[model samples]
Target: MSKEIRKFCHGAAVAAMVGLTALSASAEVSLNVATVDAAGTLRNLAGNRLHTLLREQDAGVQVRHIEGPVLGNAAQVRDQVAEGSVDIIGTDIAWAAPYSNFLKATSFSFVFRDQEHLAGVLDSAMMAELIDEIAAEQGVRILGAAVLPSRAFFTKVTPQRAADFEGLKIRSPQLDNWLESYKAIGANPTPVNWNEVFLALQTGLVDGAHGLPVDVQPNNWHKAAPNVTDLEDMFGVHVWMINETRWSGMSSADQATLVAAIDEVDAWMTATAEAESLSTIASLLDQGGGVFITHNAAKREAVAALAGADKVVAFPEDEREAMRNKALAAGKALEGQATWWAPGVLDELQSVR
Candidate 1:
């Protein structure tokens, strides 16, 4: 234990500590995020928020965004995420049906009455189970479900009654089940991509396009067709997912930070989507010069006949009936309130809480 030897050993220990600290600081992670929405669209909002949150949570981590068709459409992005070609993707549940049957539960016609019902299901244990199954089977992680408004029809020819849809050439996603539903309604369902929808309508390639008012208004779909129908048939659910391998490779601290950030963003997205729905409908009517058609009960029943009521419950038949009874006890939660900024919305949002 000479003084010189003691000094040298102490210096060596200090140097090792410094080196380890530097190594940890120098670690860098990069992730690629893909989405079908154009830049600045609500679909891209979640992606952008995620990128910001990641950077704020970890300066060493970097996220890159790919919008439009760069990574292909939403359906293509799902495959890319599963194959690890893309590190992350914002996708629709309808497109993920091929990979997971749990999605079929959400796909069931009229499963949800409005945005609140849809949000309730997404925040429920059922959606968590579905996400976990997808993660295990497809090798991708579901961050959260991004909300959107209920989908309705925007047609060139005004349909006062559901019978008017007969023989109409309507543009819809090429999913066979979806097309079959439209066919059941007596309309000729033409499958077309979102990018091709405008031209399809303008050129008379299709007579109508189906989507949410918020989705259709932003895209200026009403300019091509003047009539908007409030069928309230379907709503949009965008699932944010990341490649499991990449997520697993991250440090424990980074993984926690990423998940927490996504949870916060999901909460914000739900409220934003609810607010946007009303403004979107107004914009379509006033700015886009479209006529809004409110269907009567008989007409709605006709549309329902075409939409068909198919339920997918995870429980046995007896248990399913019991669950339905429980849901009925909840009973018409949003009844008699059709507009946003209504009195019961905050309570409805809280009920799901």
Candidate 2:
């Protein structure tokens, strides 16, 4: 429903109107694509890029973009894919967690400090192992992954110090890891879905929000709750995936086309995210928005204290801690490396036995 998506959809419709329909006939296979985010977001960026590359390769693949609720909500879209009704989807890691722990590993405490660290660690051998594990267990084929902007803290009531959160009700996703993450970070977390966020802040159902720039800027939440704290505690993570049955049904040539197209999208996304994150944050502030708080070492430390505390609500608390510890160890090993941007962290995450 965003202006950009509307424009694309309109242009496609217009192209058909003008008798450009012959070009689409070259498609040997066509697939449906959907994303929950608006057009300008990283999710849609990946979606748009895939659509172009697949077509350019005349990969015989026609991709249709179904953005926002046109197809369904996140849960419904994912369910459709699992049922083999929806061909492909672009979804963030948090929403994909019910599928497997591999999807949520990116969200584990401090696993990724910034987009650079995220790009670095995700490009590792360890991540490959997890991706295949999830595919085997969950019956989905992960085409590729991309790093979203880091989720930071934004509040209406500027905290003079960390203790000011006595009654603070910051909003987070309904997912348990996010709930625990917000609680662990020292604020009263109010579980809310993405759609309700703007109104939640507008009417004071919540005090502030903890999400990435796309979440805030697209909805104009900056007009309501203006102060931002750059904790950079977690990177928003998303994966491009297809149902396993559909994936296996495709010809190897078609499959190869998808892999190549997705690789191109991933490369473009990594660079664009690094360039866009800061400027997007500042764009919100330039037009009569709110104040940007310098980084708060104390609040970050407070959140770091709870890392691997066994408090994750998604799985057994004990099990969650063990999972987090593994991620923390791997993440710690990756810190301050100049090799963060190097490609091919692993070609194909090792296959599952």
Candidate 1: tens digits of C-alpha lDDT, residues 40-105: 567677778878877776656678877767777777787788889999787666776665433433
What ranges in model 2 sit over 4 Å off?
A: 1-27, 165-167, 296-353
**Root-mean-square deviation of Cα positions for candidate 2 versus the true structure, in angstroms:** 13.3
- Give the TM-score (vs. native) of candidate 1: 0.72
| Steric clash pairs (candidate 2) | 28-60, 123-345, 128-349
Candidate 1: the clashing residue pairs are: none
95-207 per-residue lDDT for model 2 (tens digits): 66665433343564544445666665555434443444545677665666667666756678765444554558988776655665555445678977676787899899999
Give the Å shift of residue 114 in candidate 1.
Answer: 2.2
Worst 10 residues of 1 by lDDT: 4-13
